[model samples]
Target chain A: MEVHSSTAGAAAPPLSPGDFRELFDSVDAFLFDCDGVIWKGDKLIDGVSQTLDFLRSKGKKLVFVTNNSTKSRKEFAKKFGSLGISVSEDEIFSSSFAAAMYLKVNDFPLDKKVYVIGGEGIIDELQLAGYTGLGGPEDGKKTAEWKSNCLFEHDKSVGAVVVGLDPFINYYKLQYGTLCIRENPGCLFIATNQDAVGHMTDLQEWPGAGCMVAAICGSTQKEPIVVGKPSTFMMEFLLKKFQIDCPRMCMVGDRLDSDILFGQNAGCKTLLVLSGVTTLSALQDPANDIQPDYYTNKVSDFLDLLGA
Target chain B: MEVHSSTAGAAAPPLSPGDFRELFDSVDAFLFDCDGVIWKGDKLIDGVSQTLDFLRSKGKKLVFVTNNSTKSRKEFAKKFGSLGISVSEDEIFSSSFAAAMYLKVNDFPLDKKVYVIGGEGIIDELQLAGYTGLGGPEDGKKTAEWKSNCLFEHDKSVGAVVVGLDPFINYYKLQYGTLCIRENPGCLFIATNQDAVGHMTDLQEWPGAGCMVAAICGSTQKEPIVVGKPSTFMMEFLLKKFQIDCPRMCMVGDRLDSDILFGQNAGCKTLLVLSGVTTLSALQDPANDIQPDYYTNKVSDFLDLLGA
Candidate 1:
């Protein structure tokens, strides 16, 4: 399956009524990034549920792909239901799940334990994939002394260190992760996504997973194998699981780097939405490298463009 | 004043009796890095006290320079005394002091307070320099919830966010520093040094100031004004305060990048000591770009070479 559109990463046109019909027919599935597309923090975007219902009513496949490793698929499903959206847990492909899938695809030894510098989402996904994860919320309260006579211990069985959005980032986890990656033979360093900041709250942006990953990167002097969007790993997982061809899919997201870039990497058509982190000027600027095939105001704009 | 040494960063010759005599006569003052050179984590290097006495007997100016931002100059002086070395607090130049001096040299507004993501050393030094330091130990116990409804407030008076080694590092401090650096107008992002590992304990190496600084760098999407060794800021402060010229000083240290490069950057003759983090093979490796004028097993070798 290959990209069917000629306007790949070019100055995109706004989705017209005719273009919406063309997109509706050309793509058999739509992969939407959840944070900015489906909702913003805990609040649902306007007309999001109705638009999702419209796509589902037309027999189009919808996958909610998100880089937020904070919550599990079950939690996301719960969030969707709470926001009055009808979505199953199986429709989500979070970065935490992607990380677990990455390990599974790599044939990671089941006997070796994986150390995590993330949240419970990563822990749940790893356990669901038959891997034991250590150092998540359990290590949240753990700290290394500034200057002490005591020595810290690291598990010898730690085969990998997976980093994500860890609010519990502390000195002990940093030291432990560093020791594991540096000292453990063949220890893999994996990162969910290097997002600079997150729409953590309704009012403000907070430090994202990149800060945590960068800390470990500095200490270990090693770059991690990024297993999230823009890497094509998630695309591969989605491809195998859903058995959907890239040519039949359209990717919708607010972030140009992770979403549009991931779509481009996966040989799928991409639509950039301005409802989240991006602005009109940012997309129009020639300095911006990543461009989508089509752009609109929001995910709900598809319905408005078609005069629903 | 220019360095008169013929072999600069070349295949450095070992410090022999003849070479020691030449170096002793040529340089008026000696600058020693504390951690790996003078001692290794609370224990004084062998004959280090004797070497200092010998240098004092020969009328050589002695100064202790350390990139550790964890302790104040007074604390370092006490550590030196406890280890059987009588060094004045004023003779010590720590990175924490350099950070405070950097603000003074840069003419930072006196009324603007500085936010710290480090230890009491930075706080003490900033206080000593008449700058109010917030968010060091005060924010150490503070934490941001994984998902919270409360909004975090950043001090509008914060004109700089200085980062160092903080064992008590958490998300709240990271967020606060990020806000201060990103939200405040003309807010300075200062880092003591980007040292990768700290010799925190006698048994093993721990994550360094670079980890903490890198975290802030990731969040703010900004580079810091490094104030420690290899930056020449500390060198400039030392020169102006001690009334010593770089050409008349011999810099002896362990690490190649911070210590040796610092000496070379300042146009001072350098002596590499293998008693710390660097190995002789590491120094001999032609792939290594940084080289000192002379190499020795340790700081005490100066006395051994001269048969003191």
Candidate 2:
């Protein structure tokens, strides 16, 4: 519970991982959160390219883990390239991708229709993974129509629950989602991510796909196996992709709760950047106790510490 | 788990000393939620007053238990009187009043300023209970400026954490609110209720007073002693005020979760009316599984049952 505040030029590694160690020290792979850390709404964060190059020089692997299931891996790759960062579809792990992998690996009948409650990203990902997407009832006043037609009537024909971001997600949809899961307990309850929301501009603000997932989760009292950040699913995917163990890894991010806590929980050293949801004043406040192993002002500050 | 949908009619008993006899055949003092059961948006339901008088003539006691902490018992009496119903202030059990009573009786000390994060209702109630209503930091931009003047200062003069229906509540207020309670664990954490939000024009609105309570409760991981409807606080208030015991009571309401569940938990027979949050459709939906001992189309039907 001791507050760690250091403003020295470079200090000894007194507390395990010190302030001035290489930002990517002893790390074989790196996991980054896409929206806030790498780019915030249409604009890329400064030094992301140079930092990637520096990590590439050190032979470190990079994987972008995003809870934004509304976009597929291909879509992410294209978006990343558009932002001047070179990335492959294989180098990304989205909750949708994880959900697809979960379904594929389990050998669940892929030809069946999935009652989706998300956008084009989820639809593309699931289809690419070899599953049919389900549409809601025609009348659509209540999801009860979908319940009778898509779910209950066909037992094993319903492949999985591919819940993603849909703004029109309402209580009736929530009711049907629960009803489907409750009806077929063996039917997979897969969520792309459990993130309640992502902050966009005020006018276009929308509840992330996770809010719908959570509402159903709340009703059923069931914890879905989350695939996105902070969940070990993405970390495992990244580790397997890079062929690295937990010790030889470091997690860098701006948010403390999900990003830093993810690193801490996964036994990796964490770097907290004060460029996003968390700030320096928040950490210094006596009330909050979420402290990271190392503190850097932004992702760009990694260069000063690493001397790359 | 059998669904009970019997309303006041041919099969139901006329208003007797125990309205619960037709259902549970046991129970005493009746607890009623005022917001939705007796009225909706300030409009009294049919047969509400006549039903109350009939029950009174049968020697059954009743208390108005409400989660709305803004108004005092006197205020409630006036509101009820305007609606052509005679309500004594002493017969009303308000969570705000209960919280104030708890603070006063425990000698928790009104020596410090109580930071308020609710509507004028809760603030006025706190004032009536002999506590100073303190506001948060008048300034925002500078954290240092915030530390000195904000109600969450790490000082001894702060009395407790009081929260209620605050439409203006945001991240900044929550951040400071979290700080205040964390800094002083002994500082009383009093909430108006735990409903995330209540009804508005459309959409599942924030359950007023209850939402902030839930937020703080989630953050601190400490459940506050709820004083509103469905709590023993209201039950005890009724017993003390009306000089009655539990065995001879019943409860009438529209929503099963709040009103009926309150009665069920409080050991009284519950009547569910289909005029508010929980409709007959919701109850019949299998997923909900909420069934009151008796069901009525509107609040007025209870008068017919009472033979008023």
Top candidate on TM-score is 1
Identify the candidate with maximal DockQ: 1
The TM-scores that each candidate's chain B achieves against the reference are: 0.94, 0.76
Per-residue lDDT of model 2, residues B1-308, tens digit only: 22224432223222342453464335445677776667754567667788778767776666788777656677888889999989887788777777666677668776876766665555566678888766432311212112211242344566687766554443345445555666665777876665433432122222356545654554454566666655555666566666654545667775666676666666666777666656566666656645566666665665555345
- Please write out the lDDT profile of model 2 over residues A47-154, one tens digit for every residue: 978988787777778877777776789998998999888999988888778777777777878566676666567777778988776643321233222121132233
Clashing residue pair totals per candidate (backbone < 3 A): 0, 18
lDDT of 2 at A4: 30
Candidate 1 on A18-90: residue-level lDDT in tens?
Answer: 8888888999899999877777778778999999999999899999889999877888888889999888887
Return model 2's CA RMSD, one decimal.
10.5
User: What does candidate 1's lDDT look like per residue over B107-199, in tens digits?
Assistant: 988899999999899999999999999999999899775354667888999999999988899999999999998889999999999988866
DockQ of 2: 0.06
For candidate 2, give the lDDT.
0.61
| Clashing pairs for predicted structure model 1, backbone only | none
